[model samples]
Target: MKLLLWLLLFVLCWPLALLALLLWPLLWLLSLPFRLIGISVEAVFALLRALLLLPARLLGHRGS
Candidate 1:
């Protein structure tokens, strides 16, 4: 009885498992460029913010 139940579960899930396997690579390829662009934009914003703050920080310094 347990063996039969296991077989039924396996049969039901097999298609879903195969679908995920097939789609994994395609999804990864599609998202690759978007991920890289997001990272690049984040880096540029951080650099710009740092540059903008540098002058304020230097001007606020007291020459004691």
Candidate 2:
């Protein structure tokens, strides 16, 4: 369905569609650093949370 709309758009305005197809990958490559930074930030937060929780988990295990 989405492809049909895009195909229609391409048929109607091949120039704009051609420009978008060309720019899409360039835009994605330009945005890659931001994506990587976001992923790393999330991983750091997850590691911090796990470290903070480790003592409680250990204590609970000892009780069990």
Candidate 3:
């Protein structure tokens, strides 16, 4: 789906499309740290949730 949109852009605006092609890797590199931070944040939230639920789990609470 994203490829189709990029192909359409390539047909309609070659220069912009070419620029996007060139910048793709740089954009991905720039985003890598943000992705890692997001993963860390998600893991922290999951740990908090598990810690919050631990007592209930130990008491044999069933999640449905």
Candidate 4:
């Protein structure tokens, strides 16, 4: 009787545990694209600032 109870508990909980394990990585993978987009946008802004400064400097701007 005790063995049967243990087996039943294990069976019930196993699926939930497995689902958590599978979904964790899947959720991380799904968010990866958003993370990459954020990084790229920051890079683009940095490049734009550098390019804009070059022209301002050429035009004899003291600070910009």
| Candidate whose TM-score is highest | 3
Task: Between candidates 1 and 3, name the one with more favorable TM-score.
Answer: 3
* Cα lDDT tens digits for candidate 4, 32-56: 9999999999999999998989888
lDDT of 2 by residue, 1-64 (tens): 9999998887989888789999999999999999999999999998998898889888885433
Candidate 4 Cα errors over 4 Å, as ranges: 1-22, 55-64
Please write out the lDDT profile of model 1 over residues 32-63, one tens digit for every residue: 99999999999999899889888877889543
* C-alpha lDDT values of all predictions: 0.93, 0.91, 0.95, 0.95
Better of 2 and 4 by TM-score: 2
Model 4: how far residue 25 lies from native, Å = 0.8
| Poorest lDDT segment (10 consecutive residues) of candidate 2 | 55-64
lDDT for model 4 comes to 0.95
Among residues 3 or more apart in sequence or in different chains, the pairs in candidate 1 whose N, CA or C atoms overlap within 3 Å are none
Per-model TM values vs. the true structure: 0.69, 0.69, 0.80, 0.49
What does the lDDT come to for candidate 1? Answer: 0.93
lDDT for model 3, please.
Answer: 0.95
What ranking of all candidate models by lDDT puts the best one first? 4, 3, 1, 2
Reference-based TM-score, model 1: 0.69
